[model samples]
Target chain A: MRAIFLREFFGYFRTPVAWVFLSVFLIASVGVPWFLGNFFESNDASLRIFFRFIPWIYLFLIPAVGMRLWSEEKKSGTLELLLTYPVSLGQAVLAKFLAGWLFIGLALLLTAGMPLTVAYLGDPDWGTVASGYLGAFLVAGAFLGICSACSSLTANSVISFVLGLMCCLLLVLLGWNVFGDLLLSLNFPVPLVDFLASFGVLPRFNPMVDGIVAFADLVYFVSISIFALCFNRVVLHR
Target chain B: MSAPHSTARIEANGLSKSFGEIQAVRNVSFSVNPGEVVGFIGPNGAGKSTTLRMLTGFLRPSEGSASIAGIDVLKHPIQARLRFGYLPETGPLYGEMTVVEFLRFVAGARRIRSVELDGDLIRVRKVCHLEKVWHQTIETLSKGYRQRVGLAQAIIHDPDCLILDEPTDGLDPNQKQEVRDLVNEMAAEKAILLSTHILEELEAVCSRVILLHQGEILLDESLEAMRKRHPLFGSVKIRVAPADADRSLSVFGKLEPFVERIDRQGDHFLLRSRDKRNVSDAVLAVSKDAGLALLEVAPVIPRLEEVFQELTRPQSKFIEEQG
Candidate 1:
């Protein structure tokens, strides 16, 4: 399992995918806040505007990183080789997921320079910044888990990417008013809509930006990761 | 064929597998003992790969069991997996990694660590002749080198058994011979089962063969026994003087019990018998009596390709019933 983790963790950098994902993400996460959110004009110490753009960024970029997790193995026929090993399926899935999660963590880590620049400019609330990063990490983990499961469903990387993108798009849409109204107008039940909306990351993520780390919010995101990974295991089992 | 003895290293007991409405393998069972090399031959989609997958525990059998070194593959897959190495179809590998990294990763997965791991890697690299491309990335190497690396990883642990699915699928003739040599070199100490559609491959490697067709075991016996199943198992050829050929043919026409079909070639007479019989002496006796000058006379050995077609042509069972 350790060998798999090391291989997958380093696997990101072996291709152009990692560098492209990192550079794009670093530029967008830092650039969005300054150009569109008016980071300098607001004259604020908090990184709330920066944290807000993270989910939008993750909604697009997380799938790109996670799409190759199982799809490539399936395409190259290595999935059979890996499953036949002495390692259990769960262990293999966990190792791969953690490798991808940590890769997103690294991408998140590279954006830390923004906070340092904020601190240099004004009196930044370091706790809020820390909690915000944690929120972003959890969201990344949840989205990555969904994408990894999507990758396990198909051998074609393009189909895997599209499926992951659609799933992540639905999760993000569950919290927004326009999507909620659209579902309600389609004669959806109120309680079911409320239950679905509770699974959305933005609802749980909004408070963490103000340094409010609710245990329920953490549980929700963690459950999403576990559920998605469990789904991945079940698909491979079939 | 009868089941192998209890000491067999790799065994499958009444294995069956199905995909939805279609059955891929049915009630198939065989075994390979130590120092035995078994060739598995079948056309595409004949469940050859399916059976190998079940034995390796890559696919669970729908209604059967497999064991490696006496451990049940389904019940205790890891233990069974530890006793044998499998090279799956396509020789799947991570092409991004160098040959060294690939072998080391496989060794680590198999729990061969520390100093022992290094030595095993070197040993396999030497045996597989992969020393030239040890540090080269797999994608940069040719298919032949990649296949050698595949074989190297399968044998790195030195397991008691080896299961190779089309180990030399796409290699040139020389590369194919090299892979065969590696398998033959290791055949003396391990139980080996390899699948191929090429009949001539069995000549250099396999002691026995299991012929599968449409998800059933049609034939499983010694290579010699399979050849004996050829329609013209004991055919004979006699090169005679053209002037005496007609008289020789008339003489052979009376040997009704020995000759099934007699064909006249330019200066030769080809005789196929209903059963295996010594017709060479009969021909010589007839030639002497008929005053024919016999240039050459010898028994004809059946070719593997002809024998394979005889046993496994489409609707072979129908052909068998008629025969």
Candidate 2:
């Protein structure tokens, strides 16, 4: 597992994919708040605009990172060699997942400038900024897990990316208020709608962004990541 | 051929695999002992790769079992895998990595740590002749060099057994000879099971040959025993003039007691001998008695290509009866 992690973590930088992802991610992350967001005008001394764009940025970028996780190994015939090693299937999956998550963590670390800039302009709430960063990290893990699971289902990288994007989009849409409202209008019970809405990324993520570290929200993200990783292992085993 | 050791290093007992509804291998069984080089020959789609995958713990067998050094591959995959090295049919290389990086990764994965890793890498590099291209990227290397790297990775762990699928499939003639010699050199220490369609490769390096057809083991015997069983072994050909052809036919029939079989084609007579004795001398004696002129007399050498064809051809009388 350590061997796989080392290979994969360094493999991203060996190609231009890691650089490309970081460049685009940093630009979009900082750019979203500068031009479109009411950064200076709101004068609220917080990083709400930066946290708001986290899920949208993760929805697309995580798939690009995760698409090649298993699809490349399958197409290049290295999966046969990898599986024949002295490691189990679960170990291999965990190694790959941790590598990708750590890569995203690096990208998130680069965006430290956002919160620092807010603190320079005015008295920004440091607690909210810390929680927001934590929230983005958890969401990135959840997104990457789903994308890696999609990667194991196919040998084509393009299809893997598309499937990963669709799954992430679905997870995001589940938390959208309109989706829950639409179900409620069709005579669905209130408890059922609330139960389904609780699984969405937005609901679980909103509290963290607000500096409220709820136990249920942490459990939700951890459970989703675990479920996605297990799905990845199952897909590859078949 | 040397007798196989009682302690088998590689064993497959009634192993079978199926992908969905299509059965790929069925009840195939074989064993390779230490210091033995077994050649696995088969036509394409004959389940050679699938069988190797099962033995190497890459694929699970639907029935029966495969063991390496007496460890069941399915029950204890890590221990079984530690005993053997496998080179899959595709050469399983990470093209983006340099030869050094790839070998280091393989070495680390095989559990050779920092201090001894360098020593192991140097040893494998020397054995595989990879010194010149050690720092070159795998994608930049030629196919022959890539194959050498693959071979180097397989043996880096210095396992007791090795399974190689088409190890020399795409090399040039010289490279092929180099690989053959390398296999021969390695055969002294490791039990090697290699599959190839190249008949001469089997004849050159394999002490025992396993012929598979339609996912079934057709023949398994020592190379010397297989050659001796050929009908053309120790056979001699003779030519006579048209005038002496009729007298030569009668004389040849009388000489059948000293030979195994006689085949007649026009003025040429092919006489197979049962033993190493000179059949041509007896034919000359018969010719002298009949006053027939003998034009040509030469021993015929049986070819391995003919043996492979004879064993793998479809709808043969022997296979039909077995069915």
> What is the CAPRI rating of model 1's predicted complex?
medium
lDDT of 1: 0.88
lDDT of 2 at A164: 98
Lowest summed lDDT over 10 consecutive residues: which window, candidate 2 chain A? A34-43
lDDT tens digits, residues B1-323, model 2?
Answer: 11233443889999988989999998999999888999998889999998998899888889989998888988998877777888889697998899999999888777776998988999989988999999998989998998999899888888888999999989999988988898898888788999999989988899999888888888888987656555576778999997887778778888877787888898998998876445778888888888889899887777777767766777565345334
How far in Å is the alpha carbon of B93 misplaced in model 1? 1.5
lDDT of 1 by residue, B209-265 (tens): 999988999888999878777666678888887777677878888766888899887
Candidate 2 lDDT over residue span A1-238, tens digit each: 8999999999999889999999999999889877788667877788888788789888889999999999999999899888877888899999999999999999999998887887888888889889999999999999999999999999999999999999999888888898999989999999998888877999888888889989888888888899999999988873
**Candidate 1 wrongly placed segments (more than 4 Å):** A177-193, B1-8, B250-261, B281-292, B317-323
Q: What's every prediction's RMSD, in angstroms? A: 3.2, 3.2
Q: How far is B299's C-alpha from truth in model 1 (Å)?
A: 2.0
Maximum-lDDT candidate: 1
What DockQ does each prediction reach against the true complex?
0.68, 0.71
